[model samples]
Target: NREPQLELLKNFQKELTNYKENLEKVEDVDSYKKDVSFPKICKTNDDKRKHLAELFEKELRDKFREHSPTKTIYTRTNQI
Candidate 1:
C-alpha cells in the first residue's frame, strides 16, 4: 500500500516537473499580446461590466446581510 502511494507521489512530481518545463518553454509573445489586448477590451466594456458587477455585489451583500446576525459588519468590507 505504501509502495503504491510512493509511486503515485513520484509520478505526480515527474508530471508536475514536465508540465513546468513545458510551461516555461512557452513563448512570451502570446502572453504579451494577451496582456495588451485584454486591458483594451476590458476598457471598452468597462462601463457595462463594472455596472453589472456592482449590481451583483450589492444584491449579494443585501441577501447575506439579511441572513447574518451582524448588519454593519459586511457593509464596511471592501468588495471587488
Candidate 2:
C-alpha cells in the first residue's frame, strides 16, 4: 500500500521536476512556434501540457494498466 504510493510520489516529483526544467528551456517564448508565433504563449503552454501528458502516460498510466481491475490489492491485506 504505502510502497506503491510512495513510489508513485517519487516518480511524480521526479517527472514534475523534469517537466519544470523542460519548461525553463522553452521560456524564451519566441521559439515554440514559427508561423504560429503570434500564439507564442499559448503554444508554449500547449507544448508543456502535451509533454506532461506524455509523462503521465509513461510514469503513471502505464503502471495503472498492469493490474487487473477485478484483482486489485487494497490496503496492506492480500485477501481483499
lDDT of each: 0.48, 0.53
TM-scores across all candidates?
0.35, 0.37
RMSD to native for every prediction?
15.0, 8.4
**What clash pairs does model 1 have?**
none
How well is each residue in 1-80 modelled by candidate 1, as lDDT tens digits?
35654565565556555644554445542352342333333443433344334444555546556555554566566452
Task: List the candidate 1 regions with Cα displacement exceeding 4 Å.
Answer: 28-80
- When summed lDDT is taken over every stretch of 10 residues in candidate 1, the lowest stretch is 32-41
Per-residue lDDT tens digits of candidate 2, residues 1-80? Answer: 46775676577667767766665667553455343324234455656556544544565544643543422453224444
